[model samples]
Target chain A: MLFVENRELVVPGRLLAEGDYFAGEGTFLEGGKIFSAVIGLAEIREKSISVISLQGRYIPRRGDRVIGIVTDTHPFGWILDLNSPYTGNLMVSELVGRKVDVFREDIGKFLRIGDAVLAEVREVDERWRVQLTASERGMGRIRGGRLVEISPAKVPRVIGRKGSMLKVLEETSGCRLEVGLNGRILIRGRDLKKVNAVVEAILLIEREAHLSGLTDRIKAKLEREG
Target chain B: MAEAKPEKLLVDGRRLDGRRPDELRPLRIKAGILKRADGSAYIELGKNKILAAVYGPKEMHPRHLQQADVAVLRCRYNMAPFSVEERKRPGPDRRSMEISKVIREALEPVLFLHLYPRAVIDVFIEILQADAGTRTAGITAASVALADAGVPMRDLVAGISVGKVDGTVVLDLMKEEDQWGEADMPVAVMPRRKCITLLQMDGNFTPQEFRQALDLAFKGVEQIYEAQKEALKEKYLPSLEEGR
Candidate 1:
């Protein structure tokens, strides 16, 4: 039996379900009952139950696309803060797709501190050491896009199902948005007003992440403001 | 040297504020009030106003403090200069320092700290008004802020003070009762599990009185736990109700 309806608001430790249900992310089971582990909207799919959290710091996972800020430099790579507990290491070789001699080559020419980067997580060790790669097309040091960060937990909502919300955001506002799993979003648009409107809509999704029918509301908002 | 005791703490079964013994002061709690902090809460308990904020589970600066197996939980309990009749000096006082340590320990038991090793979680509790039981109120508010931040925990910790005034046990002591009470004990408990995470005592209590005081504290904490859960839910549910 599910104690809460689908999309119902749930707080940490609120009983979610019982019996054969499998607990998923943001939920835990104990003593034959599944309970939420964060304040969010309860999501139920068949026998699996999870809660979509509204607020949380980003935790990096392997293969996640992230936008990061270069914060420091070491011998082989530049350390990037992924807006998360763990920082990602972007080796110069990985960024340029070539091997370079440390003594002969200057990595500073590749990436400097305060540079914003779009990279993919290559690997994560048990110690949470993350390695990043930017050699892929359209990945590397980002330039000339207004950056906006919402709560990382709300990133999926901004993307919507199958990129539906994102398509609507870009099409209505005439902006191209590059969203990072770590919550950093970059917007490029010819119209400044439209860019700011996209930022407003993203923040609205964060504030109302627990509510249902958000995609329609967002589309309505974008059209009304545009 | 001895201070004079008040003439009557309980008159016709009512305390000075017209609340019965074993009764808690009025409480109002709001979650996620601040914009910058990862999580924040504001609480008013019998005029003892407190605000709590949680940050991080991010990097722990000064590197040497990083724990290999668990995240470090840091708590700071500070009373504002204008909180009381007499101005409190700025900075961490001895009482505040001790309260900070115990509060950290109180919250550590429930957190899934191992999930974020090498990171640090900071809980800041600021007392804007002082009417006794500030530490307990701070703990209650801090736990709410932690939950608002989405920190996974076994359960929420609820806290209250129990004391003996006029040789009778009471729950949630006001400043006046604290000043004249025979004993003052602040306690924090994981209400669902009924496990004590914090217990500090001053003055006197016999074994029997201590047991009774714990009973009262547990009951008070249970009520506080409900309110804490409600505070988090209230932030999202009502707006959702209207949307539907």
Candidate 2:
């Protein structure tokens, strides 16, 4: 039995459901009962129950696209700060897509500290060591763009349902967006004003992600200002 | 102040504070009070004012302190120099150190620490004004702060100090009762499970009085549990309303 309506706010330990409910993010099951593990809105999708958390740091998972800042370099790879608890390790081979003799090539030529790169989380080991790969097209060092970061938990809302929000953002503003699951976004546009307007819209979304009719509001705002 | 104990602590079934044996002090809790903190809460219970802030699930510093399978939970309980009647020396004292350790233990069971290995979650509890029962109030606020930080936990912990004063079992002790009471017991409970995570005693209690005190503590904890949940909602409810 579901005890809460969809999008109803719940606090930790509040009983959410009972009997055959699959616990999703921000929720846990205990002895035939399901309870919320964080303060957020309870979401019920079919038979699965989850709470969309309003606040939290990003925890790296496989196949997630993230933006990372190169921080340190070692013999075989470089360490990238993923804006999370775990750092992402991108090998020289992973970035170059081929094995090269580290002794012969200066790895620093490809990427240096403070250079932001768009990459995919390839693997997260049992120890939470994150391995990143930027071999795909448009997934290398970021050269020029405006970077805006909000809470990682709100990233999904920015994307909206089935990329609808992202489409609205790009179509209306005439800008391109690369949204990282780790709460970092890159906006590139020929017109600086349109890009800044998109940035403002994104910030407004982050602040009001929990509200309904947000996508329409954002679309209207972008059409007006962009 | 070193004032002498009063001859009578209770008259007409009213303690010095004019509260009944089963009455609790006024408690107010606010969540997400600090702009910079990942999560923060301010709690005022009677004269006890405490602020708790939680930062992390971030990278743990000092490589050796990192846990292989679980995040390390660190707590610091500090009282402001002007918090008490006598000016307290700033920094960790023996009493505050002990309280910090106990508070960490009280909150540890509820957290899913294994979810974030090699990370550290720091809980800082500052006593801005204290009139006894500060440790219990601190625990109450710290739990809310942790939840506010979006840390996954099985439950929230609520705490209160109960004791025997003037040979009468009382719920929620004030400074005077704590100082002159026969037995003071601070108890923390995960109310959902009815499990005790922290239990400490100072002074003596008869078996009957201990059982009564424990019952009273649980009742007090239930009230605190409601307030904790209410505080968390209060922080987010405004946005929730505006969304509609």
Candidate 3:
């Protein structure tokens, strides 16, 4: 029953009462009287009302791997842009398990700006800054390849169920495909035609991510077009 | 106000393209037009086209502002440089900011922000054309997008513009009227409540003239609202049957 003031029902909740204002989502009512703004639809379930509000951009979560670009470097960590409004930081300590000898001046030699890296969004600190780590294998500076940026929300769809989509893209394009959880995709190939083909495939995946049987259809398209 | 000398009428007593006052230009709306956005729609009103995307009631982060009670509405209104006759500079400007603020307010009354406290809902409206009433068009487009996204709302909000041109009140003013008209008023309202969530008027208007203009806008809004609902129903009704 959650709704916006003049939009459609976004969330299905319950109808609480008839009113002119919306009282946020999860609003409580007693004696059949609404006590909040009726901005969204009022869902009446047993004894409570829920309001559905608008949607926001995606944020990184724990255990989520993402593709990020190095934005800045500091003694302790390197700042990375996850293509989100918020940037994440990767600590040098997290990069290596064992402490290694390194001077402050030499930190830049290890990781420089614009170097695309794969990492995990560990946690958001109290200040809401994202912290990342790239200690795992298959997660590090992306080697020579073409990069494509897609909507972060489409990443899950592009990855498909259990890495199936990536497998298909790699097989068809004849390129090594690496999808960062943060929505950065890297297609590694020497042939320009193959690289362009892979990019087109990824874009197609992004554009048609919502429909069922998308992977199979995309495979067919690639087989025919490639 | 120093009146800019009336440039010879583009058409005798007719708007450019020859439409009369109170006449609506062709309108076409398509919902669920974008794949990545949770809900998206493209709207073409006369020569003006706009796309709107709606995303979330997910998790409210930053921990500090997280209200267990409501969601935040973050609206960004942008116009592509190619949207207008003259290329607009890319990025937010004073005009765009004002439109964004107005649109946010227009949508705020409809969203159940308290439900996802500390969480944020982002509505991005992109103008692909700029004939006139882009703000109203953007609002109308966003309303359909929210529906397409499945965001719950009490009712559909409709937006329309009214202006005074040559001492005459007109509905759905075009670009010329907007530039030379004595007043331009854009309103966003929840047709069900008959209440306005967004209202802005630029230019002079006598009390009677203002009332007349508002009435004209409301009439135009009813027509626009019907169009919005019909477009959404046409697009989503099929999904409903499939679910059944």
Candidate 4:
């Protein structure tokens, strides 16, 4: 039988019980004749229970795009802040097709501090440090645009199914929009009003992306205002 | 927090749903709310609900890091998997760590650590429903838990978020405002000292806009601090009179 190890479920407290099936997070297993700490509700899986622990920096996976800000520059690469404990290094060679010799003091000419960019994750070391590369078109420094960051977990919702949400933003606001899978969005438009409108729309999407019938609502709003 | 639709537009310069810029959506706080914890409180600010618990001023095991002069603060900030629109994998993420660290620091200054030497003070904050200002709300609720635990503190810390949207600085942005607004600045303040314990900003803002946002945050903090004090007083004052 499942029983609560701790107190009521209204507060931020732990719940536990010895059982074969893992109850998982956000659940309380409560009943009779139970032992405390027998099983934690968070991080539990089928027939397995895992303790919650915090360590290591965030690492990026292949096909995962992230928002990065250039923090430091080196002779061959630039250091990037990926909104995680780990810092990513983008090699200069990845930016250009051919190896171009440059003066050591002139690295800042290419990228400087506080410059936001979009990059794809290439590799992650065992230590959780990320190595990034920007070797493809539509993947590099964001130019003449506005950038917005949201929770990384919300990235998929922002993109929507088969690029449907993105299509709406582009078609209505007439902005060239790029969304990195890592929760960064870039919106570029000559009209400040349109740019502002698109940014607001994206933010709304991030907040309410879980709800259904969102596209039609956003489309109608944009058409009426834009 | 749910998304904001346009039909929800402005009514008399207020939100489409009729909320003022400085007005809170709705707030609820309950103390002594958990039986298992030494002290606990559940706080709901708008759609963001967080529960905070104080577990111990107990013996430190492994016996290695115990200090002779003060108690160590152990804090864990977590988001439930179903707290957001998408189900998150159950674990601590980088954002949670950063928030936990700040919360630990915020409590350290307020708590009288020397009172519980060689022991540990454990604070666990969990986000039940996330809107825009989870951290701020967490910090506020944790203070209530600490107070309920009878932990001595100089003053309560209050947190709030201020931002610029459409060239207008607003106080206590909803989730949608935070996501779409041009800038968001969350601050944790000590009302007694008028000093800030935690501050973080994202998005674009001019220096002037930053100052304006901070001003708005200070205003918001004052209002929240009063509510916190009221909640604490309501919880403990009657009990204190009974003890006497």
Candidate 5:
């Protein structure tokens, strides 16, 4: 039995469904009933019931592309702050793409503290130890782009459905965007004016992500300002 | 100011505040009131104004304090120096410390702490103004703040204080009643399952009076739980409705 409609705003402990429903993220099952575990919009997809939370810190998951900042260096690896409660560790081999003897070479040559790197969450253990890899093309240390961070929960709105909002952002402003699920967006453009326009639009999106017609407003703003 | 106690707390079934024995104070709750905190709420029950903020599950500080298998829940219950009639000491005193511990325990059962291992969730409840029943109000506001923070929980907690004044069991005690009454019991409940989370009494109650007080507290909790849900919806639903 379904208790809440699709996309209905629900608070914690509101019953979402019952019987054969599989509980998904933001929901829990107890005594044959599925209930929302956070304040979010309930999503009923076929046999599964889940709630999409509107606010929260980003939790690292495998295969998520993220932007991390180097905060510490170790003999064999470096610790990268993922803008999350947990930090991601990038081994020297993962960044250099090959084994380099820690005793023979100073790993500091490849990366240093305060350097921003575009990396992928390669693995997250049961204990929440995150391992990141940056060896792939366009995945190493980020060099000349303006970074804007917003609430991680709003990253999906910036991406939009099937990357439509992203395409609008890029096409309207003429600025390339690298959006991290962790809420860090890197914008690069040859024209400073267009880059600033993109930054403003991103902030606007973050502020009004829950409103309708946001993508159109962003597009119109970028076209007028960029 | 020490004043003479009224000869009778109730006159013709009404208390000094012109309320019935079972009446509650006017309540107003607003969620997401603080912009900086991850989640926050401001609540006013009659003259008591309280603000509650939740700032985690973030990385726990002081490495040794991090629990290996679950996030640590910490609560701080503070009263502004001017919140009371007499100036309260600015910092955490013995009473506030005990309230803080009990508040944390009251809220811990609802949270899915194990989901955020090696982290800490901090709940800070500030009593901006006090009449009476601030601790129970704090628990009620803190639970809403936790939900506002998007912390996963099985249920939300609601609380109320019931007591006896003039040998009559009453619901939602006022400042005068709390100060001069024969018994005061603060009870917190997980309203969804009717589970009692925090129950404390600081005076005398007969066994029958205790049962009546418990029932009254549950009734108050039901009303508070509804208000809590409404507050959460009021903060997040307008945007959600427009988006759809």
Candidate 6:
């Protein structure tokens, strides 16, 4: 039985369910009861109950796309700051997709220390050592784009239903948005006004993601502002 | 406390502040108010105004201080020079340093520190206005800030002070009561488990009176806990209900 209503904001230690439900992320099972482990909105599915936390530091997970800045370099790879508690290691092989002799070749020719890289988490161990790969299409170094950071939890809302909101944003504002799961969004457009409009729209989504009918409101806002 | 007692602290059944002995002063709490901090809260109780900011579960600095198994909880409790009636000196005094230590311990139990090993969680409390129960108020605000920052915890901590004044156990003592009452005790409790994370007493209390004061403090903390929950809901959940 559900003790708290679905989509209701629940604080930590709140009893979310009591019987015959599996606990998911942001929830813990004690004896026969499930309790929320963060301040977030609760969700109860067919057999699982979980909470969607509204605020938190991002934890790196495998297969997650991330945008990171190179902070330090090791003999094997460059450490990328994932805007999370843990950093990601982007090896020269992963970035270039080829093996190189460290002594014979300078890896700096491919990526600089301060360059931004669009990458994906290849692996993460129990100790939070993150391995990043940027050999995929449209990955690797980011050249020039306005970068905006939002709450990581709100990234899904910014993308919206099957990329519907993203499509609308691209079409109306005439801009392409490369959103990272780590909460960094890169915007590229010829028109400065349209790019700024997309930034505003992203901020609005972050603030009002909990509300409904946000897509239409955003469309209206873009039309009015554009 | 003042050396001399007032002729009457309770008129009929109400205390000097026009409240029952068990009533708490008005509280205003808001979470996630800061832009830079990971989590932050602003609280106003009676005439006391406080701000709390939480940072981390991030990497521990000083390389050597990182605990291999758990995150370290560090807290700082500071009062502005102009916070009280008299202008106080700035920086960490011995009293502020002691309060900072106890506040850290008060919040450590609820946090799931082991989840983020080799990290540190910093809780900073700044008192903008002084009241009688600043330490309790600081703890109350810091816990909310921690939750706002998305730190996982067993439960939120709620705090209050109960004191004996005019032979009566009054809840949430006022500044005047804190100074003039016969005894003042501040208590912080983890509301879910009903465990005392912080307990400090001064002045005097008989065995029976101490138990009664604890009961009143528990009652006061219950109310504070409710407010803390509502404060968080009001920030994120109210919009969803409003859409309907």
Across all candidates, the chain A TM-score values are 0.94, 0.98, 0.72, 0.71, 0.95, 0.96
Winner by DockQ = 2
What local lDDT score does residue A3 receive in model 1, on the 0 to 100 scale?
91
Over the stretch B149-194, how does candidate 1's per-residue lDDT look in tens digits?
Answer: 9888777889999999999999999988999989999999987678
Instruction: Give residue B181's error in model 5 in angstroms.
Output: 0.4
Candidate 4 residue pairs that clash: A3-A31, A4-A30, B8-B16, B9-B16
TM, every model: 0.96, 0.97, 0.60, 0.49, 0.97, 0.93
Candidate 3: tens digits of C-alpha lDDT, residues B10-62: 35667656777676778888877887887888988888989999876554456
DockQ of candidate 6 relative to the true structure: 0.63
lDDT of 3 at B2: 45
Candidate 2 lDDT, tens digit per residue, B85-112?
9999999989999999999999999999
Ordered from best to worst DockQ, the candidate numbers read 2, 5, 1, 6, 3, 4
Worst 10 residues of 2 chain A by lDDT: A77-86
Chain A TM-score of model 5 versus the true structure? 0.95
Candidate 4 structure lDDT: 0.69
Interface RMSD of 1: 1.5
Q: What does candidate 6's lDDT look like per residue over A64-166, in tens digits?
A: 9889999989887798988876789999989888888989988878887888899999998877678999988799999998999998888988898899888
By lDDT, the better pick of 2 and 5 is: 2
Model 5 Cα lDDT, one tens digit per residue, B1-244: 5988999899999999899888889999999999899999999998999999999888888979999899999999999999989998899999999999999999999999999999899999999999999999999999999999989999999989999999999988989999999999999999999999999998999999999999889888888999999999999877777776
Please list all clashing residue pairs in model 5, or write none if there are none.
Answer: none
Clashes of 3: 52
- The regions of model 1 sitting more than 4 angstroms off are B1-4
lDDT of each: 0.90, 0.94, 0.72, 0.69, 0.93, 0.89
Could you tell me the TM-score of chain B in model 2? Answer: 0.98
- Tens digit of per-residue lDDT, candidate 1, span A46-121: 9999988878889988899999999999999899999998899999888999898989988889888999999999
How much DockQ does model 1 earn?
0.66
Can you tell me the CAPRI class of model 5? medium
- Residue-level lDDT tens digits of model 4 in B1-244: 3555444333466863467766666777776688667667888888998999986665566568777678789989999998988898899989899989988997777666775566677899999889889988899888778766645455677888887666577787787777766788888887756778889889888888888878888888878777776675565445223322
Q: After superposition, how far is residue B130 of candidate 4 from its true place, in Å?
A: 0.9
Span of 10 residues, lowest total lDDT, candidate 4 chain A: A32-41
